[model samples]
Target: MRKRVLDVAEESFQARGYHASSLGDLMMAAGITGGALHHHFPTKKALAMAVIEERVAAAVEQTWIAPLLAAASAREGVRSVFEAVAAELERQGFVRGCPLNNLAHELALADPDFRIALSGIFSTWRQALADKIASDQQAGVEQGTDPQRFAALAVAAYSGAMSMAKTAQDASILRDCLAALKPV
Candidate 1:
């Protein structure tokens, strides 16, 4: 039941802004009656927070951390993550912005907790990438690629490119951005 609620909330949260979404809609989407929803989550806001927490961790691990850990070279691993993003943009037709970033922007003004949580998640991601870059630098001495700066720039570029691609409905733009990133 918890999984169902979270899954349904994720779908709604991804499809519509959190402010525009309601408990009734979430329950309906989950195929649960009113009581069933309350049994799992007393309030829609609480459920949203849970969804944010779970989604943030999952997104971070799958999109960035995993790739960074998997490659023989941390640098190549970081590169792979960006490449994966470009591939996803192409796969999705570039119509949807990242769910996490979208939710952050929407919930920032409405919910301070949500904003804080989202910022923390992003900070973790940035730190992970920066650490990986630093690791690569220590092993290979790749000068001109300041680990912290590279990590920050890469994420900013990725998010900005994704935003633009989503706005234009052109996934190719994401690929173009990835291609422009220095091969580190």
Candidate 2:
């Protein structure tokens, strides 16, 4: 039941902004009663935090971290992750944008707890990319690159492209962004 509630809440929160989505909406979508809902999550914030810590973080690990670890080079790893994400957007035919970015944009300023949680996720993501880049640099796969700066740039570029893609409702923005990231 707890997992069910979280699954529904994750979808709801991603589809609708956290501030705009209420417990009533989640309960209705999950087909659960108030008692049942509260039994698992004492408050909406709690539920959102759980979704961030569990679902969103796990998705990042699976989608980005695992691929990056297996990639032969930092550049290839970043490219692969971006290409995979772009392909997924094309497959869905709808760009809902990154769930973490969505929540960060909406709640980062208003809620400290949310800001902390989201920041942690971003830090983890950046660190993973940085570590991969550093490894590649040491292996001579990536020369003349500052792993930290490159990782930050890659993450920022992807986030900006995601925002533009979502706003324009065009998946091509992602492809273009990935193209820009490609080495000469």
Candidate 3:
């Protein structure tokens, strides 16, 4: 029941934004009563925080961090990720942007806890990428670049590209941005 509620809330928040997804709607979607939801999450904010910390963070790990770490090279991994996501968005025929970015835009300024949680996730993501880059540099697969700076820039570029592609309703923007990021 707790997982059901969290799943419903995550989907709702992703589709409708935090402010717009009322508790009533979430309860209905999850097929749970107020008593059940409150038993697990005392407040809506608590539920949102759980969704961010668990669902959103896990999504980033599965989609970005794990894949990048598992690949033979950071450069190849990042590029492969870009291409895969572009193909996915193209197949879906719509862009929803990054889940983490969407939540950050909606809830970061609304509460300090939300900002802290989101920032922590972003920090973890950046650090993972930086680790991969540093490994590649040490292996002589890359050179003359600061891993931290490059990781930050790559994340920022992907976030901006996703936003633009979502707005333009075009996945090609992602591919074009991938071209610009060829050096890394």
| Each candidate: RMSD | 1.7, 1.0, 1.2
Can you write out model 1's per-residue Cα lDDT over 1-184, one digit (the tens) per residue? 8899898888888778787788888888888898998887788888888888897568777888888877766567766777787777677664667777788778877879888888888788788888877777778756657777877886787778767877788777766775665554
Candidate 2 vs 3: which has more TM-score: 2
Give the runs in model 2 whose Cα sits over 4 Å from its true position: none
Which residue pairs clash within candidate 1? none
Each model's lDDT: 0.77, 0.89, 0.89
Candidate 2 residue-wise lDDT, 76-100, digit = tens: 8888989999999999899888888
Q: What are the per-residue Cα lDDT tens digits for candidate 3 across 95-171?
A: 88888999999989999999999999999999998899899988987788788997898788788889898889898
RMSD of 1: 1.7
**Model 1 spans with C-alpha error above 4 angstroms:** none
Better of 1 and 3 by TM-score: 3
Shift of residue 159 alpha carbon in model 1, Å: 1.0
Ranking by lDDT: 3, 2, 1
Error of 2 at 103 (Å): 0.2
The stretch of ten residues in a row with the least summed lDDT in candidate 1 is 175-184
Clashing residue pairs in candidate 3 (N, C-alpha, C atoms within 3 angstroms): none
Q: What shift in Å separates residue 13 of candidate 2 from its native position after superposition?
A: 0.9
TM-score for each prediction?
0.91, 0.96, 0.96
